[model samples]
Target: MKPGLELGNTAAITAKVTPDMYAQFEGQIVHRAYSTVSMVYHMEWAARQIILPYLEADEEGIGGGVTAKHVSPTAGGDTITATATVTGLKGRAVITAVEVHNGKQLVGTGEVTQYVLPRSEIEKKLASEQAK
Candidate 1:
């Protein structure tokens, strides 16, 4: 990690809802609206943007956890935005509060937790998992 990451830092991502983002299970579409899974991915991406500028060449940020609640449905072609704000930082952990919206309506909210680790450490962990 490099310098300059702080609390209250923010980032956002805007996307238009599409059929691919619809609720589905095992390749079967369950609903033709935006899915919780897609919302969570956007939330994580927004959080990742906050750390990108601060990471060193040898450091990588990994998803630690995510908690989300889908409050409303958004149909295909509706534009949605996900924003993340840094809420806490402890040691190598970065915690962010995230919100998803379709225009003025709140669609979902969540928390994203990320851990900064050495790139070598991450690669070693991946290798260990593969060997298992």
Candidate 2:
């Protein structure tokens, strides 16, 4: 990490719902509404934006955990926004609180945690897991 990452920092991404984002399982569409998977993906992207400018050349942010809930349905073509706010930072972990909204309606909410580690350390961990 570089410097100046602090709580209350926020980032957001807006996207229009599409067929591909619909709830599905094993290639079968389960619902015509936006999926929890897509919501979480957008949430992570929004959170990642907060750390992008602060990461050192040798540091990378990896997903540590995610907690999400799908509270409302958004149909295709409805624009949605996922926003992330930095809520905590401890050691190498950055925690964010996230929300997904369609206009004034809250579609979902979640928390994301990311771990900043040296790229070499991450690669070594991957290699060891693969070797196992």
Candidate 3:
């Protein structure tokens, strides 16, 4: 949970683009631009996998922040890969740097902030507030 703890640690996740994931805008041309490249979702999936293992069963995680830039466009049938590195930890929150790539090109890169909390504790607190 330190700044350098995640520096060299890396995890990779893969996602395949399918026709069902494509977006169809009304009156717009349905092209590769409308396809869900799978890179965007892959990045989030990798981040969660990297952070969730460190949490307890009763704990829940929320994405507090994300700074990402989509660089390239990928088409359907292409497989995207996402990698996440833990860069730092602030209290119960873990800061990570993520990158998504399609074959040889980088599709996206960014940082994510995730918070860890006990699920039961959070629900109980909400219930108490509602009862007040």
> What's the count of clashing pairs in each model shown?
0, 0, 1
**Scored by Cα lDDT, where does model 3 land?**
0.72
What TM-score should be assigned to candidate 3? 0.77
Candidate 1 local Cα displacement, residue 103, angstroms: 0.2
Rank the models by lDDT, top first.
Answer: 2, 1, 3
By descending TM-score, how would the candidates be arranged? Answer: 2, 1, 3
TM-scores, all candidates, are 0.97, 0.97, 0.77
Candidate 1: where are CA atoms >4 Å away?
none
Q: Which ten residues in a row have the lowest lDDT in candidate 1?
A: 1-10
The residue-level lDDT of candidate 3 at 111 comes to 80
lDDT of 2 by residue, 2-113 (tens): 9899999999999999999999998899999899999999999999999999999999999999999989999989999999999999999999999999996999999999
- Lowest lDDT sum, 10 consecutive residues, model 3, at 32-41
Off by over 4 Å in 3: 1-7, 23-30, 33-38, 124-132
Pairs of residues at least 3 apart in sequence or in different chains that clash in candidate 1: none
Is candidate 2 or 3 superior in lDDT? 2
Which pairs of residues collide in candidate 3? 6-86
TM-score of 1: 0.97
In model 3, state the lDDT of residue 37. 35
- After TM-score superposition, the amount by which residue 119's alpha carbon in candidate 1 deviates from its true location, in angstroms, is 0.4
